[model samples]
Target chain A: MSAAAAAAGLVLLAAVGACAGVVVGAAYVAFMNALRVPARLAALTYTRHMTRIYEAAMAAGAFLAAVWLVFPYTLRLAPAAAGFVGAAMGVYVGMLASALAETIGVIPVVARRTGLGTWVTRLIWFVVLGKITGSLIYWLYPPLVP
Target chain B: MPTVYLKPRDSLIVAPGEDITLGMLAEFAAEDHELERTLRGQPFLPGLTEGHGAISVSSLDLVRAIRRQRQDLDLRIVGPAHTVVKPRVRPNPVMAGIWTAAVTLLLFFGSLMAIMFFHADVDMPLVHRGVYQLVTGEAAPRPLVLQIPYSIGVGVGVLLFFNSLSRRKPSSDPSPLDVQMHIYDQDAQDYLVSQSAAAHRADQARQK
Candidate 1:
């Protein structure tokens, strides 16, 4: 492949990845909304189901990596490998986004229900600070896993 | 076919090969005032029975229904028992199927969109590029050897961090996701219990 063609391909991949990320983030929000009723109806079961999905995703990712290592280069497909990785990463990212959304969503309701306005604000800020700290840690450490 | 000894009262024998329902038990113990009243009041809830040296409800559906009503009733079964009751919630199959489909759809689209976004934006070539450069002397377009290891390492790291497949986690190490899920489940249950308790209290107050 020519240098110019390679550069163009790289740019296209980057653009695709960015667009995908936004869509994934949006889907995550939609998922949380969808989950709310089921969760309220059967919290334990719903939570168990979510955990199972996460575990399954993680296992699929590991299995994919194993397959990649065992299989010959001739049989390898970049798109397939990338898709599996992305899906696994998507599940993990979607979960984190959902948790963040839940935290933000629940605080106000909790505060109102309990009338602990000051406590809620303090708790929210504490969580926000913790998230900020985690982001900084991610920048420094760079996730070993996607 | 276990003979459920309604404590301090006579034992009501369940007919063999026939599943004992709350209605059947209530009918059997129609003569006993305390036992009959309790059974009639919550006729759907399963009676708690002792089996395999442990006390457990014979029917989970009954337990689920009974839990909502804050009734002080000691319904225990005694004697040698052969029944092994599994803790299960018998949900409406149609509703369960619908919810399952809904959840599956949500997860599929949610993961797909999120994956596309993250893969395209942050975790694309850049993440690989950095890892490859760190491991190998070459930059930008790193060798296949370096890239492969890094990519595989990403999967391994995720497994290790999540600790999902393993029954035992390394030392006290538990996945943050698992911890969060536990907390969420506990909070929901606590909330439900509190709501039920409050409703029970209100009902009692109204009766008074």
Candidate 2:
């Protein structure tokens, strides 16, 4: 690809990504709700209005996240702060991704469909391990996915 | 002595004036048919005279109420100690609508951001270009052919995956969201029951 073509492709890709982002984000939140994170948080706090607060926080957080993702920048943080941020992001992403699977009753449905009733626990461990491995590969060697 | 095995429910919704019987509050199995029938029929709470909200009842309370009538009964209480009795009332339409709208908007924006972030992170445009070039053996500045179909596919894929197309669902199967909501409801109810149980324990300790 020529230099001009590559630049144009990047721009076009950004446009497509933005559109795809909206759909994915909405679906992610919808699935997150299925996981009942907001509900559980509200119940834990013993506040009826906590759900609204949680939703608002999520919306604002997501907006900030989008901004961070789109604008290429490097932040120098203390190791502790970096660790905390990484842990928080990991938790949020993990829960959101798992929500899609759990909400759809993936384990139960897969077990029933495959007639692996006895291996339900094993299947769960497999999913967990599989996710960890895939994530490790993606982060460790991004070229694999690309 | 009748052995009554009591498994307390997490929550029960009742009408304002409805009588709450032992059977409605908990699942109890007893050896003696006559005693079981009598215990099940026993009034736990006198028809709510005034209140129209939740009233937590503990297993201890149930056992006490049962023992009041039959001192010779042996009660084995299993599961959570409390049951939250809520009034069955239709929610206000306006409030419900507002809540729904707020949630819908929030989720839409949040998910959109997440997807965009992932795309930007991976440099998806470059990926697309690579795939397009590999397939066609030509460098197209704007791969509308591949991009357009892929974009449309994303939306359709979401609809199918979520099992919802607007309001008219394509299938009778419960959507993932529906299943999650159910699970959340169950979790919330369990939390409430446990909370009530803890409160009951604290109250008893204070009384002693």
Maximum-TM-score candidate:
2
Mind giving the per-residue lDDT tens digits that candidate 2 earns over B1-208? 6578999888888877889999899988877788777778888887664446567787888988987887887789998777888876655678555644544444345444444455458675575554455445566555445554443344333433344444544254554545554565566677776776788779989999
Tell me the whole-model lDDT of each prediction, alpha carbons only. Answer: 0.42, 0.59
Interface RMSD of each: 14.2, 16.6
For model 1, residues B93-139, the per-residue Cα lDDT tens digits are: 68655644544444344433443454456755565444344333245
TM-score of each: 0.31, 0.51
What is the lDDT, from 0 to 100, of the residue A90 in candidate 1?
30
* Fraction of native Cα contacts reproduced by each candidate: 0.00, 0.01
- Where model 2 places Cα greater than 4 Å from the true spot, the runs are A1-146, B31-34, B47-55, B78-80, B108-114, B163-175
| Each candidate structure's count of clashing pairs | 11, 7
- Classified by CAPRI criteria, candidate 2 counts as incorrect
Candidate 2 displacement at residue B40 in angstroms: 2.3
What does DockQ come to for candidate 1? Answer: 0.03
